[model samples]
Target: MASVIIIGGGIIGLSSALYLSEAGHQVTILEKGDLSDNCSFGNAGMIVPSHFIPLAAPGMVQQGIKWMFDSKSPFFVRPSLNPDLFSWGIKFLKKANAAHVEESAVPLRDISLLSKKLYEELHQRGEFDFGLVEKGILMFYKTQKAAEEEAHLAEKGKSLGLDMEVLSRDACKSLQPELELDVLGAVHYRCDAHVYPNQLIKGLVSLLEKNCVRIARNHEVSRIETSAGKIASVAAAGERFSADHYIIAGGSWSPAVARLAGLRIPLLPGKGYSFMAKEPEGRMKIPALLAEARVAITPMNGSIRYGGTMEIDRINTRVNLNRVRGIVEAIPKYFPDLHPEMPAEKDIWFGFRPSSPDGLPYIGRSKKLSNLVIATGHGMMGLSLGPATGKLVSQIVSEQQPEIPLSAFSPDRY
Candidate 1:
């Protein structure tokens, strides 16, 4: 078995380590942070097969333009003269068409289903409990436009063999009887699930360590040594770690990491925020997506996690409380009884999602580097798609056929 080194200890890197180690390969994960929190941990924790439509779909450009003016809008792209943003925007505009969405649906659904199945298997093993719940997710919509959009999405999901049903306001209330909803209706994505990400990440780290996988925390990759079109070693924290194969799973920093290896990964860091609020009443039995507001609310660890907003810009430490206010305000509009308070800046958790121009993740072997794999660009679906991406990475490294076609997620597509 080959020795492997994975950069960026988020869900993608950890999941890759999990499968690589299971395949008998020696694996090491180099994490810049202490692995205490990341996009993997702070998310709403919904495993959504319902999100088949890529972010680059049609109408997004117009909607994003309208949102840019709103301080607390769900999506905002910082206006900038940066060449990277300009180039990414051009690519995004080119792909935001009906054809692209139609072409992307199948690939997205397949990977999502694969990951959901893997999650179930992991939960069944009972090695650790991450509070994996398959009660499904509800896409709640108050406006007629949002309701129509969700209904259309439900039809598409059903056509793709997913279990989805458009429900009336009464039907929706029946599912979560304790909460008083003011929404017009909801689409219940019965194919979706949720898990407590904190437990999942910690449990995976423990399991990997027990299986002899070295997890080097506080070690950030500073340099990539290459020779003959292949990576020879990675330098981090005054040490050089050599491995037979290297995988770049560095979340939003993937572009910087790839640059060290003389590769350009067209990606942007979309910063999002979330906070945990008390849900002592257990009013929410199912996860919910506010369709118009673009907020996600999920019940986990006996608390409700409210997350939203997609601010496309350079990764930064500043938290925009206005966006958090948007999330808080939207909750009461949908479920009138559930009102989340505006969390303090210190309480807010933010993470950068590695969003690609085309809204599809890059998940294949690099064309320039024979022994290198690129597996970031998951955007908001990193946790939802982690295991499947990891399993595919293992298959690629083992010289076996991938369980699904990789043409859609090819790292060399650009």
Candidate 2:
């Protein structure tokens, strides 16, 4: 069995470790932090097979431009002179077309369905409870424009063999009778589900450690040694670790990690924030995505988690309270009966999402480094796509056929 070293112990890295260890490989995870908080946790926790459209779809450029001026808007791209950002923007513009969206739908749907199936299997094992619920998610929209867009997406979802239905405001209210809704309509994505991410991450870490997978926390990779087109070892925290194979799953920090090996990954960090609020009534039976506002609210762990905003910029520790307030304000606009107070800055949880120019994750072996597998740039769908990406990484390392074609997710596509 091959010995593997996975960098960045976020959902992608942890998931990769899970599958690799299960495949009889000696696996070790090197995490920069203490594994208590990461992008894997503090997310909306929705496992959505409904998000078929990539972030680089048509009209996104115009929409993003309009949103740039608003401090509390759902999307914001900081104006910068960085050449990487310039290059990424050009590539994003090139791919932001109807054809790109059409071509990406199948690959996204297939991987999402695969991940959903894997989540179901994981929940069935009963090793740990992550609060996996399949009650589906509701995409609520207030305006006719948003409703029309959601209806169109629902039709596309139906065509892709996903269960989805456009419902009227009355129908939506019938599902969540306790909560008063002020939406024009909603699309219930019956194929989607939710999980408590905090439980999921903690449970997976415990299970991996019990299965003999070494998790080295506070070990940040600073150097990569390559020999004859393959990774030889990784140096982190002034210590050297050698493995037969290396996988880079380092979320927003992947570009820096890859740069050590003389590779450039065209990616950016999209900062998002979320906070928990008490929902004593437990009135929200279904997770909701505010269409126009771009916020996600999910009921988990007997509380409600509200998250949103996509601030494309460098990774930083700054918390934008305006964005969090936007999330708090939008909740009451949709669920008139539910009003969550704005959380303090300390209560807000922010993480950087590694976003690729083309909106597809990079999940294949690197062409320059033979023993390295690149798996990051999942953007907003990291938790949603974790298991499927991990399974594919294991297959690639094992030299076996992947469950799905890898052309769409090739790391060397650029």
Expressed as tens digits, the lDDT of each residue in 215-270 for candidate 2 is 99999998888999998888988999999999999999999999999898989999
lDDT of 2: 0.94
Q: What's the C-alpha lDDT at position 298 in model 1?
A: 92
TM-score of each: 0.99, 0.99
Candidate 1 lDDT over residue span 88-204, tens digit each: 999999999999999999999999999999999989998989899999999999889888888898999999999999999999988888899998999999999999999999999
Predictions in order: lDDT: 0.94, 0.94
Range of the 10 consecutive residues with the lowest summed lDDT in candidate 2: 336-345
